[model samples]
Target: MALPVASPVVIRFGRLGDTVLLAPLLRKLHQRYGTPCRLVSLGECARTLYQGSADVAQVHWFASQHGWLWTNPRRLAVALALRSMREAPFYICEPDVRTRTKVRPMLALAGIAAEHCVFIEDIPLGEGEHWADWLLRFADLTPAAFAATPALDASRQLRAPSIRATPDELAEARAWLAAQGVDAAQPLVLLQPANKRTMRWNGVRAADDDDKSWPVSRWAKLASAILQWQPDAHVLLCGCAAEAGYLASIRAEAGLPRLLAPTGGLPLGLLRGLMELAHSMVSVDTGPAHLAAATGCPLVVLFGHRWPSMWVPRSASGSAVTVLGGLPHTPRVDQIGVEEVAQAWWRLPPRPVDIVPAAMGERRARVA
Candidate 1:
């Protein structure tokens, strides 16, 4: 089969973290085709998430979790939207069987055929291959690979799941941070203690039994400990407006000064700025954690029983990152103690910031 006349069309949908991981493949495909790629997802974040990237030409997404009645229309709508664009190669990045079946019809509705599509399940992963790396490898199968002259440093944007923030966005975020009293001259600690699984009650299971839960009380203690360790440090309980309630709970429980909650959730652009500006972060295995790592924020991430190598957020080269739990034998993230989190966070070599005298004294003794 020949390359599409326009560019590659990638169908990959995931939660925020999964969406972030898709960056590498889009980048690789764009370089190989010398064109910005079109993206399809099950959720809406991809647009805002990729707003600053030229590599993603457009993002089309709809709800996928509901029953067929609601989802099928959305699927058709997506197919209709893509139909307006030129024909392109389709890469289905999901390994899930149900998801793959769901996407096939969408492609069909768009008049894209099987030969033009590459289901990721067709490519078995190499031993211990992370999914992000697997996606990067999948990008190599494009017809562009056989050309005499290849892209310079072709497919080399593999370091981390990066998101670009525009200069205007960064400046806007800085102004907002300053207004919120986020003193750049002091140690800024960001915390992501809420996950969708735990935040929404499903009735069938307790949220605490899940991997994402680490006890809201425990989060309070961790925040207090951070404040105690660095009096000048500002702890921001970061999440979307929906999770503002959880943020409030943690802020109230911690009951200490210098901890602030954003009035609404941090916008994607501002969130990127926060990740870049923060000295470090502590989070459970979640989307913002992935985003934070991409921004080169030193991360102390708590993992569940799943294999860490499969889903752990990869920070930029040589940045501080500590992965605790996620071992095969690990039962749950709650099994991870508050002290363990603090120790891992303390061990991270502080990201460069203009430190106040009070915080500077503590960082020198703790970073080593």
Candidate 2:
């Protein structure tokens, strides 16, 4: 049976990886409904990544303050939802458990009955299933149907995750690279070494933060090794603008002053452009790895203790996005060696053409 094609909405909020991982679920929605969707998302960066999606019709950005519901009522969320989807018999999919509690109440306030909403808890949580697969389940897709869908393209995204930039944005990124002494002709290897690895709970022991990060020292070593292996390779160290000092420390620690550093405030769209142009990427489990994968960039993703089968980016056929993990059962990021990572770097095919030259090509390159 054909699902409704009009005014379907998906509500999701989390870090960049969570947004990127929504690719498969979004594709399933489009396949079932045969139309793009409206998205209710949070954060400017996540909004930037999904706003122009071919599978998503519109994105409603929700800003949550750090105070009482009275000051920022739950009604605000319902208004945001209704603004995108009115009384037109809409479908709502909420994938995150964290948001489920709040979203249910918001929908009730908007007078949406129970049947209209889809929650993760409603679906049977499969053991060791990838979250993307879990999302398909939440959408009521059968396993066989899930397998039949074009997962590679879908995992790339309903539209491939891109940092579509205007001419000025492209020039700005190129100029920054040039100023950092990056050779336009050489292979650019991007290094994303830092992440928001910890979040506090109850002002006590940090929860949901484990060893997903490779140390800065490890990153420095890996950067130096990459330089040694590819002498002409231009290395760009990337992080959120707030991590400028941290990125600098890695460069300083590696003692590679010529390493390119974009300003911390570089827009996410421009950053995606830079990723698309790069020869390859090396990072711990971070959002940029997933973004790089979307661009068809060869990547070596290091997992400290995270499950690669569950969390690694969707890669295309012949994708060099290698996943290196620690011992089975007890993964440790620090346990992974520089030599092991360097081997993965060596496995990547030679760098393709610099994207700066083909700056105006199709935003999503069909990864062959």
Candidate 3:
């Protein structure tokens, strides 16, 4: 008889972009162990990410206040929220030191046995190791395992993150795009101009960190150039609701009045479906860029704050080009120029003929 399968719990509490980076790790787990494991996360995007995901058994949302885990009610709340996973083995994937401190106490409170959990802190990531590699190592898996995992050999995993969208969601995206005057004939270029992590209020950023958002001025210039290069291209802005203000600023700054801004809000699933329809996406270092990569949409990503070695967006095969910050540790978006991004877009394999809207008839028929 086969031994009982272990039902592991995965813990990752990073926001949108971090969650996108986590995709490959989850895929490998699903390949190794066929069942979906429980995932614990704090990101709103996590729910949508794993909704139909074969890798996720269920998602537990844990809300913790800004104060330390040692505090009263906040600690108790976290403990209660995670009480369900007390009996299962946990794969703790959060890397930040502060998160590590909080996770241990929560596990103890939730009645989880100490031996049943594996923390990233147990075997800290080595110097220069990619985050995904760090995760595979955390699982005590061999390097050969990583090599054997399809789309993970070498750096192929970078382009291999995957997400599934429902038929209803695809219909909604197409309907919404049709309403917005986006047609199948022209190339749809998604321009994600907003980076919420770095935006400031009263000149104070939420965290004094840099996630590398390309400046709006440069984005406008790039938008103008894309239009010049691909005359039939339609530039559509995309981001979470929080980044609306910043997106509007880019729109005004770019002076492209014809840019399509879909009416009302677009949910994560709808946005993902739209990504599949897009010809190419040009994004600053952000979450939507990752979603685009999962759809295998041709992408050009601009990286400034984080090193590409640490957080470059991955896509299957050669679907993405990462432009890193030229300056040392504190590089600004200006470090990358519009010409370089346009050049990267130029290099993408001419959009495959079968993926074109005209050839998308079969998919559309299925949805119909």
TM-score of 2: 0.80
Best lDDT goes to which candidate? 1
Best-first order by TM-score:
1, 3, 2
Error of 1 at 284 (Å): 0.1
What value of lDDT does candidate 3 attain over all alpha carbons?
Answer: 0.66
C-alpha lDDT of residue 322 in model 2: 85
State residue 295's C-alpha deviation in candidate 2, in Å.
1.5
lDDT of 2 by residue, 220-314 (tens): 88888888876777788887776777677778889875566656645677777677567788887888788777666778888876677677776
lDDT of 1 by residue, 253-354 (tens): 888778888768987778877776677899998899888887777899998866788888886544677898987767588888999899888778865443
TM-score of 3: 0.82
Worst 10 residues of 3 by lDDT: 142-151
List, in order, the clash count of every candidate structure. 0, 1, 5
Which candidate number maximizes TM-score? 1
Candidate 1 stretches with Cα past 4 Å from truth are 1-4, 69-73, 143-157, 201-207, 352-368
Question: Model 3: per-residue lDDT, tens digit, 43-138?
Answer: 567888778777776777655535656664644665676666555557788778877776777787787776666667767767666666677656
User: Per-prediction RMSD in angstroms?
Assistant: 4.4, 6.1, 5.6
Instruction: Sort every candidate by lDDT, greatest first.
Output: 1, 3, 2
